[model samples]
Target: MGELKLSTKIGYGMGDLAGNLLFQMTVIYLLFFYTDVLGISAMAAGIIFLIARLWDAVNDPVMGLLMDRTRSKHGKARVYLLYGSLPLGLATIAMFYAPDLPMGGKVAYAAGTYILWGMLFTLVNIPYSSLTASLTDIPQERTDLSSIRMIFMLIGVIIVSVATEPLVSSFATPSRGYFSVTAIFSLLALFFFLLCFRLTGKAASESRKKDESYKLGEIWPLLLKNRQLLIVTAASLIGNMAVFIRETSAIYYVTYNMGDSGMLPFFLGIVVLSMLAANLMIPLATKKWDKKGTYLIGSAIGVAGSVIFHFIPYDQTALIFLFGALSSFGIAAISTVGWAMIPDTIEYGELVTGKRAEGISYAVYSFSQKLATAVAGITVASVLQWSGYAANIPVQSDQTLRGILSTLTVIPVIFIVLSMGIIRLYAIDRTTYEGILLKLKEKMS
Candidate 1:
C-alpha cells in the first residue's frame, strides 16, 4: 500500500453515487417485479432469486480470481469499469422487458440474463471493492474515503428509491409503463456507472505485476490467516443480509403492512435522510470510535429499531418509519465504513502474511457477499412462503398475513442482532490497526 492523499480519496467518493444507484435498483425491486409485475408466483420468485443468487455466489469468486490476473495500463480493475457499464445496463433493461412468454420461458430468460448481469457486476465490483485498500494504507484516510463513497451511494439510492415506482405509476398504462420506466431509470443508472468509470483513473494505483498470477490454494490460506479480512468478512456477511432484507422488504412493509403504497417514497425519503445524517457524522464517529465500535453501534441501532418494530401495533406508521429511518442511519455507518474496512483488511492480510493476494482476498470476500445474498434470498423467499405469503391473490389468510409481518420485522431484527454481536468480537481497534499498518510499512520498505 502507498501513502493516501485526501484529494484522491475524495475523488473516489465522487464515483459512488451513480455506481450504487445502479446496484440498488436491482437489489430493491427485482423480487417484487418478478412476483407481482411479471406474474411469477411468490414461491417461484423466491426459488428463482435463490437460484440466480447461487449462480452469483459461484461467479463472484471466479471473477475475483480473474480480476487478479488481469493486466492493463489502466491498472487491474479500471478497464472493466470502462467496458462493462453499458452491457450491465442493457441486461438490466432486458430483465424487465423480458419477452412475455410461458412461465418457464420467463424464468429461464431471467436466469440467463441475470446470471450474466451478476457476473458483470462482480467484474466491476471486485476491483471496486479492492480499490480502497489499494488506494492507501492509513485507516483514518480509508474511513474518510469510505464515508465520502457512502454519501454518494446514498444519493444514488435516494434517487432510485424515491423516483422508480412513482415515475412508473404516473404513466397512463400501468403494466407497460412500469417496464418503460424501469428501462429509462436503468439506462440512467448505466450513465452513472460510466460517469464513475470515467471519473476514476489509475493514479491512486501503484504499479504491480500484470504478469503475476495467484493460485486459489495460495490465496485461501492467506485469507484465512489474514485475521482482519476474517473479521470484516464475518461482519460484512451478516451486515449484508440485514441490508438485503431491508431493501427487498421495503415494498412489502409499505404496501401491505402500512397500507399506504404511495407513502413508500416518504419512508424511503426517511431512509435517505438517515443516510445523510449518518454520513455527516461518519468521520467524527470513525475518528473517535474506530471501525469496530462504529459497526457495533450501528448494528445496535438496527437491532433496537427492529425490536421496536415487532412490539408496535399495526398502523403505527410514524413509529415504524421512525425506527426504519434509525435503522437505516445505523446501516449508513456500516455501508460507508464497512466497505472501507474490507480493503483495509486486505492491508492487514498483506501485513501478516506478506502476500498481496488482493484478488483472492477480495474474491473470497466477494464470494461471501454473494453467498450471504443467496442465503438471504432463499431465507426470505422460503420464510415468506412458509408464512403463507401468496402473490397476485386478492386476500390473504391470517396465517399468511402474520407470516408476511414476521418476515418484515422479526427475521431482520434477529439477523441484525446476530451480526452486531459478531462484530463485537472483532478485534481491530485503532491502536491495533495502526500497529499492524506500522509493521506492514516497515516490512515493505
Candidate 2:
C-alpha cells in the first residue's frame, strides 16, 4: 500500500468528528430525554427505544447490501456519505420535535422518526466504516486512523457529556430535556454531517467487483459463515451493552444514590481524564503491546473496575468516582483498538469468502452496537420503572436506590465478565492483522 497522504488522514479524522458528535450525543441523551422530559414512563421509554432499535436490526443489513452494490466513480461507500447526510440530519431533528399529540400518538411519532433516523444513520455509517479499508491497506495507517478517529470520537463524547444537559436547560422548560437537547444536537449534527461530506474525498476501488449488486439471500450466509466475525461480533455486542449502561445509569445513580446532581459533571470529568489518558497512551501502547494486547489489557481493567465498584461504599461518593476513573482508563484503550479490530475482521472475512462485504461487515458490526444499546435502554428504563423511579421527585424510596445501585454495580459486572471471555476468542492478533494487510497490498499492487 502506498503511504497515506497527511490530507487523507486529516480528512478522515475531521469527517469522523462530525459524525460522532451527533452519534455520541444520541446514545448519551436520547433515552434520558424520552423518560424525563417527554412525560413518558421509564418502562414506555424503554419499549420505544427497543422498538426503534429493532428497526435498525432490519434496516442495517439492508443498507449494508445496498452500499455494497452501489457503484460510482468516486467509490462505492463515499458517495452515500455525500448525498445521505442531509436526510439523516433532518430526520434526526424531527424525531425529537414531533407535533403535540396524545401520549400514544407521541410514542408513535418518536418511534417512526427514531427508526427513520436510524436507517439514515446506517445509510451513512456502514459506508463510512467501510471507507477506512479503502483508504490504505497498511496495518500501521489503519492503527493511526483508528487512534485519531477514537480520539475525535471521545472529544465528541465529551461534548455530549458537557453540553446536552446544559443545552436542554437553555432551550425549553427544564422539564423537557429530551425535546430541547435532541433539537439542539440535531442542528449541530446537521452542520457536522455536511462538514464530513465536504472533508472526505472519494477513493477509486482498485478492482471492479463483479457482484457489486445486492443479493438479499447471500448477505446472511456471508455473515453467518464467517466464524471469526461471529466471535468478534458477539464480543462487540456484549461490550457495547456494558458501555451504554455505564453511560446511561450515571444520572440516576448520581441523583438518586448519591443525592447530588452536581456530581454528574465531576464523574464525567473523570471519564474525560480517563479517555485523555488512554489517548495519550495509544502510540506507546501500540508500540509495546500492539492492538490485541492493548485491548486485552483494557478488558481486564474494565472487569477489575466493575468488581472494585461493587465493593466501594455508596456513601463514599468521591472514592467511588476515583475508581470509576480507573475503569474508564480501560474503556479508553478498548475504544481505540476495538474499531481498528473491526476492519481487520472484515479483511479476514474477505480472505475466507473471496467476497468484499465491507458494508455488510460494518453494518452487522454497528447492528450489534445498536442492539446492545437498545437492550441497555430497555433494561435501564424497565428497572427504573419497576424500582419506582420518578424524575426530580422529592425523594426516592430505599428500594429505588437499591435498584439503581444493583443495576450499576451487579448487572454490568456480569456483562463485562462475559465480554472478556468473548474477547479472548478474537483471533486476529496484531501479527495476523499486519500479515493480512501485507497480503492485500501485494495482491492489489
Candidate 3:
C-alpha cells in the first residue's frame, strides 16, 4: 500500500466535521431547545431524545449490513455521504424549527423530526466511520487518521457550542434564532459532506472494487466471536454515556448553577478546544504508553477534574472553566485513542474469523454509542423532572440546581470509571494489534 496522502486524511477529517455539526448541537443544545424554547417539559425532551437514539441503535447495524453488501460506483460507505447528506440536513432544520402548534402538535413534531434525524444520521455516520478501515489497513495510519478526524470533530463542537447562542440572539427570538442557526449549520454540513464524499471516493475506489460480499446471516456470529470488539463496544457504550450526560447538562449547569447563561459557548469552547489539544498529543502519548495505558491516565485525569469541579462553589466561574478544560482534555484523550482502537479490532476480528467485516464492526460501535446516548438522555431528563426543574423559569429551586450539578459532574465520573474497568478487559494492546494485522495479511495472501 502507498503512503496515505495528506489531502485524503484531511478530507476524511471533513466527514466528522460534517457529522458533528448536527451531532454537537443535539448533545449540547437540543434538550435545552426543546424545554426552554419549544415549551416542552425537560422530561419529555429527554424521553424524545432517548427514543430517537434507541431507534438508531437498531437502525445502525442494518445500515452497516446494507453498506457492506452495497455495490456502487461511488463505493459502499462513500455513497451514503452523497445520498444521505441532503436528507440529514433537512431533518436537522426540521428538528430545530418550532411551528405555532398546540402542545400535542409540538410533541409530535419534536418526536417525529428527532427520530427521522437519528435514522438519517445512522445512514451517514456508520458508513463514514466504516470508511476509516477501508481507507487504510496500516494501524499507525488509522491512529493518525482518527486523530485528524477528531480534530475536525472538535472544530464542529466548538463552532456550535460557541456560536449557537450568539446566532440565536442575532435573530428576533430564541425560536426563530434556532431555526436560522440550524439552517446555516445544515447548509455548511451538506457542503462538507459532499467534499468528504469526493475525497474518500478517490481513496476507497480500489478497495471497493475488490471488496468481498457477506450475507446478512453471517454478521451475527462474526460479532459474537470478536471478543475484543465486544469489550471495546461495552467500554464505548459507558464512556459515551458519561460524555453525553456531561454535554447535555452543560446548558442547564451554566444557566441555573453558575447563573451565567451567556458564558456557555466560552466554557464549551474551552472544553472542546482542550480536547482538540489532547488529540494533537495522541501520537506521542501512544508511542510511550499503549492505547489502554493512555486511556487509563486520561480517564483518571478526567475523573479527578470532574470530582473537583463538583465541589467547587458555583460562583467561581474561572475555576469551573479551569477544571472543565482539564476534564475535557482527559475525555479527548480517551475518545481519540478509543476510536483509533476500533480499526485495530476490525483486523483482530478478521484474523480470528478469516473474514473482514469493517462495516458490521463499526456499525456495532455506533450502536453502542447511540444506545449510551439514549440512556444518558433519559437519565438526565428524569433527574431534571424529579428534581423539580421548571423550564424557562426565572429562578431554579435549590434542588433543581443540585440535580443539574450532580448530573453534570458526579454521575458522569462514575460512568467513566466503570468504562475504564471495561477498557481493562480489552485485550488488543500494541503488540497484540501488530500481531493480529500481520497474521491477517498473511492469511489474505
Candidate 4:
C-alpha cells in the first residue's frame, strides 16, 4: 500500500477532533453536571451511565454488522460518516441540555438523551475507526495516522477542559451555558465530519472494493478465536477505565481536596497539554521500542506518576500538576499505540479465519471503550455517594475528600497496572505483524 497524502491523514484526524469535543466534555463534566447542576443524585446519574452503555453491548455489534454488509456509492463506512454526522451533533446538544422538571423527570430525560447520544456516537465512531484499516495496510502509515489522530484528539480535549467552564460561567446559568457551548461544538463537529467525508473519498472507495463481507453469525467465532484482538481489546478497556476514572473524579478532587473549583481548567489544561507532548513523541518512541514495548514504558510512567500524585500533599498544587502531567503523558502513549495496534489485528484475524471484518473488529473494540466509560462513571458516582458526598456544598467531610483523592489517583494506578499486565499477553510485535500481512497478501492473490 502506498503512503497516504498528508492532507488525507489530517482530514482523517479531524474526525477524532470532532469526536473528542463532545466526548471529553461528557467524560469530564457530565457526572458533575448531573449531580451538581441538574440536581440528580450521584447514584442515579451513575445508573443512567451504566444503562446506556449496557445497551451498547447490543448496539455496537449490530451497527458493525450493518456496516460490514453495506454497499453504497459513498462506500460502506464513509456513508455513515456522511449521513450520521448531523444527527450525532444534534444528539450531543441534547445530551447537555438541562430540562426543567422534577427529579424523576430529570433522571428520565438525562437517561433518554444520554442513550440517544451513545447510539449515535456508535453509529459514527465504529465506522470511523474501521476506516483506518481501509485507509492503509502499512504499519508506519498506520502509526502516523494514529499519532495525528491523537494530536487532534488531545487538542479537542484541551479545548473542552480549558474552555468549558469559562464558557459555562459566561452564561446567566450553568445549564444555559452548557447547552450553548455544546451547540457551538456540535456545529463545528458537523463541519469537520463533512470535511473528513470529502477528503477521504478515494480511500473509502478503495476500502469498499477490497473488503470481504462476512455473515453476522461469524462475528462471535471470529472474535473468540482472535487472541490478539481479545488481548488488545482488554488492554484498551482497562486503559480507558483508568483514564475516565481520573477524568471523572478530577473536578471533585479540585473542588474538595484542593479547595479550589476555579482552577479546574488550568489543571485539566496541564494534563491534556502533557498528553499532547507525549503524543508528539510516539513516532520516535515506536522507532526505539516497537509498539508493545513503548506501551509498557508509558504505562510504567503513568503508574509512577499516579503513585506520586497519591502521596503528595493536597496543598502542593504545583507538585499536583507536575505528577498529573506525568501520568497524562504516559497515558497519551498508551492510547496512541493502542489504536494503531487495532488496525493491524484485522489482517491477523483474516490470516487465521480467511475473513476480514473491519466493522465487527472495530465494533467490539468500540464497545470495550463504551464499557470502560460506563464502568468509570458508575464507579466514581458510587464511591462519591458512599463517601458522603453532597452536591453544592462548601465543604466535604475528610472521608469524602480522601475518597475523591483516591479515585483521582490511586484507583487509576491500579487499572493502569492491570492494563500493563494484559498487554503483555498481546503477541503481535512488528515482526509478527509483517509476517501476517505477507501471508494475507499471498492468500488474497
Candidate 5:
C-alpha cells in the first residue's frame, strides 16, 4: 500500500461519521423512545434490545463471511458500502418511526424494525471495520486512521447529542420530532456512505484472495487461536458496557435525578467535547506509551471520574459536568486505542493461522460490542423495573432515582475495571506486531 492521502483519511472517517449518527442516537435514546414515547414498559423495552442484539450474534458473522467471499470490482469491503448504504439509511428511518398501536403491536413493531436495522448495520459496519486492515498494513498509519475516525465519530455524537432533543421538542409531539430528525439524519448518512465508497476506492485484496481457501467453519478456530483478538474482544465487551450503560442512563439521570430536562444537551455535549479532546490526544499518548499502557491510563481516569460522580450530589451541576467530562475523556482513549488495536490483531491472526480473515475477525469484534449493548440495555431496564420506575411520572421514587444513578455510575465503573484487567493480559507490543508483519511478508514471499 502507498501512503494514504489526507483525503483518503477523511473519506474513511466519513463512514464512521455516518454510522455514529444513527448508532449514537440509538445508544442514547432508543430505550427512552420505546418506553416514554411508545408506552412500552422498561423491562419489555430491555427485552427488545436484548433480542435484537442477540440476533446479531448470528447476523453479524454471516455478513462477515459474505463479505469475505465477495469478489467484486468495488473491493471486498467497499462493495457493501456502495450497495448497502441506501437500505441502511431506510432502516435507520424505520427504527425511529413510532406507529400508533397497542402494546403488543408496539413491541412487535419496535422489535422488527430494530432487528432489521441491526442486520443492515452489520452489512455495512463489518465491512467498514474490515477496511481498516485492508487499507494499510502499517501500524502507525492504522493508529492515525483510527484517531481520525474517532474524531469524526465524536463529531457525529456531538451533533446528535446537542441537536436531537431540541429537534424533537420543536415538533408537535416527541414522536414526530424523533421521526423527522432520524429521517434527516438517515439522508445525511446515505450521502456520507456514498462519499466513503467513492473516496476509499478498492481495498487491498491480495491477502483476501489467499483467504478464500479457508472454510467458513475455520473462522471460529482462527479467532479462538488469535489470542490478541480474544483479549481485545473481551476488553471491548466489558468496556462497551461502561459506555452503553452511561449513554442509555444519561437521559433518565438528567431528567429524573437532576430534576432538569433542559440540561440533557449540555450534559451530553460536555461528554462529547471531552471525548473529542481526548481523541486529539490519542496519537500523542500512543507515541508516549504503548497501546496497552495508554488503555490502562484511560481506564484509571474513567474509574476515577465515575467514583467522583457517584459521590457528588445531583444538584452540583458544575461538578457533575466536570467529572463526566473526565470519564468521557477516558472512554475516548479506550475506544480509539481499542479500534487501532484490531487491525494489528488481523496481522497477528494471519501469522498464526496463515490466513487473513479480516471480515470474520471484525465481525466477532462487532458481535461482542452488540452483545455488550444488549446486556447494558437489559441491565438498565431491569434495575429500573425492579426499582418501580414509571414512565411519564413527574418525579420518580427515591429507589428509582438510586437505581438510575447506580446504572449511570457504579455499574459502569465495575465493567471498566474488568476491561482493564482483561487488557492487562494482552502481550502484543510494537515489537511483537512488527515481528508478526515480518513473518507474514516472509510467508508471502
Candidate 6:
C-alpha cells in the first residue's frame, strides 16, 4: 500500500462522523429519551439499556468473526459501510420515535428498536475501525488517521450537542422535535456512509490477505495471547464507564442541579469545545509524554476536576462550566489515542500468531467499550431511580439532586482513576511497537 492521500484520510474520517451522528444521541440522551419521552420509569429504562447493550456487546464479536471470513469484491470492511447504512439510519429514527402505545408495548418497542440500532451499528462500526489497521502500517500514519478521525467525530458531537435541545424546543412538543432532528441526522448519516464507502479503496484494503484462513474458534486464543489488546481493553472498559456515565448524566445535571433544562445545549456545547481542543492537542501531548503518560496526566486532571465540581454549589454556573470543560478536555485526551492504540495491536497479533486479525482485534476493543456503556447505562438509571428522580417535575428533591451530582462527578472520577491504574499494565510503547513492526517486515522480506 502507498501513502494515504488527504482525500482518503478525510473519507476515512467521515465514516466516524456518520456513526457519531446517532451514537452521540444514545450516549448523551437515550435514557432520557426512554424515561421522559416514552414514559418508561427510570428503573425500567435502566433495565432496557442493560438488556439492549449487553446483547449488543455479545453480538459484536460475532459480526467481527463474520467480517474476518468475509470475501467481497467491494472489500471486506467497506462493503458493510455501503450496505449497512440505510438500515442503521432507519433504526436511528425509530429509536427516537415514540409510538402511542401502552407501557409494556412501549417498553418492548424501546428494547427492540434500540437493539436493532446497536446491531446495525456494530456491522458498520467494527468494519470502519478495522479499516484503520489495513489503511497503513506506519505508526505515525495511524496516529494521523486516528487524530483526523476523532476531529470529525468531535464535529459530530458538537453538532448534536449544540443543536438537539434547540431543535426539540422548536417543535410543538419535545417528542416531535426529537423525531424531526433525528430524521435529518439519519439522512446525513447515510450520505457520510456512502462517501466513506467510496473512499475505502486500495489504501484501506492493504492489510487484506489473499490466502487468509482462520476459524472463529481461534479468536479467543488470539485475544488471550495479545497482552496489549487485553490491557487496552481493560483500560478502555474502565475509562469508558466514566465517559459514558458522565455524558448520560450531564443533561440531568444541567436540568435538576442547575435549575434549567434549557441550558442543556450550553453545557453540552462547552464539553464539545473542550473535547475539540483536546483532540487538537493530542499529537503534541503524545510527543512530549508518550501515550501512556499523556493518558495518566489527562486522567489525573479529570479526577481532580470532577472531585472539585462535586463539592462546589451548582448555583456557581461559571465555575461549573469551567470544571466541566476541564474534566471533558482530560477525557478527550485519553480518547484521542484510543483508535491509534488498536492498530498497533494488529502488528502485535501478527507477530504472535502469524495472522493479522484486525477485525477480531477491533471487535474485542469495541465489545469492551459497548459493555462499559451498558454497565454505565444501567448504573446511571438505577441511581436516578433510587435517588427519587421524577420526570417532568419542576424541581427534584435534595436526594435526587445529590444522586445526580454523584452520577456526574464521583462515579466518573473513581472509574477514571481505575483506568489510569489499569493502563499501567499495557506493555507497548513507541520503542516496542517500532521493534515489532521491524521484525514483521524482516519476516515478510
Best by lDDT: 4
Residue lDDT tens for model 6, 215-302: 8678889789888888888888889899989988888999889998888888888988888888788878887887888788888888
TM-scores of the models, in the order given: 0.92, 0.91, 0.97, 0.98, 0.98, 0.97
- Can you write out model 2's per-residue Cα lDDT over 1-445, one digit (the tens) per residue? 3466676666677656667766765666677667665666778778777887877878898888888888787678878877887787777667666466789987887778778877888887788777677776666677888877777677767777777666666655754565566566666666665555555563334423446554888888889867777887887788777777878787788777887766776777677768777876776787788776777788778778777887787679778888888877886665567677777777787767767788888899889877887888887887888888888685799888877876666787777778778778878767787787677657667
Better of 4 and 6 by lDDT: 4
What would the per-residue lDDT of candidate 3 be over residues 1-445, giving only the tens digit for each residue? 4458899999999999999999888878888888888998877887787677767766877788888778778888888999999999999999999989999899999999999988898899999998878888777788889999999999999999999999999888999999999999999999999999988777788552346477777888899999998988888888888888899898889988888889898989898888999999987787788788888888999999999999889899899999999988997766788788898888888878877787889899987877877787788889999999988786899999999999878899999999999999888877887787677668768
lDDT of 5 by residue, 4-30 (tens): 778888999999999998888888999
In model 6, what are the clashing residue pairs, if there are any?
Answer: none
Q: Give me the runs in candidate 3 sitting further than 4 Å from their true place.
A: 208-212
- Please list all clashing residue pairs in model 1, or write none if there are none: none
Segments in model 1 whose C-alpha atoms lie over 4 Å from true places: 1-7, 172-175, 205-212, 393-395
Model 3 Cα shift for residue 346 (angstroms): 0.9
Model 5, global lDDT: 0.88
Give the runs in model 6 whose Cα sits over 4 Å from its true position: 206-210
Q: How many residue pairs clash in each candidate?
A: 0, 1, 0, 0, 0, 0
Instruction: Tell me which of candidates 1 and 3 scores higher on TM-score.
Output: 3
Model 4 agreement with the true structure over 1-445: per-residue lDDT tens digits = 5689888999999999988888887899999999988899999999999899889988999899999888888888889889999999999999888889998999999999999999999999999888789999888889989999999999899899998999999999999999999999889889988888888888767652555577777789999888899999999899989998999999999988889989999999999999999988998889899899999999999988888899999899999999999998888777899899999888888888877888889999999988998899999998999999999897999999988988978888889999999999988878999899788778878
Q: Per-candidate RMSD vs. true structure?
A: 2.4, 2.6, 1.4, 1.1, 1.3, 1.4
TM-score of 1: 0.92
Give the whole-model CA lDDT for all candidates, comma-separated. 0.72, 0.74, 0.86, 0.90, 0.88, 0.86
Worst 10 residues of 6 by lDDT: 204-213
Clashing pairs for model 3 are none
RMSD of 3: 1.4
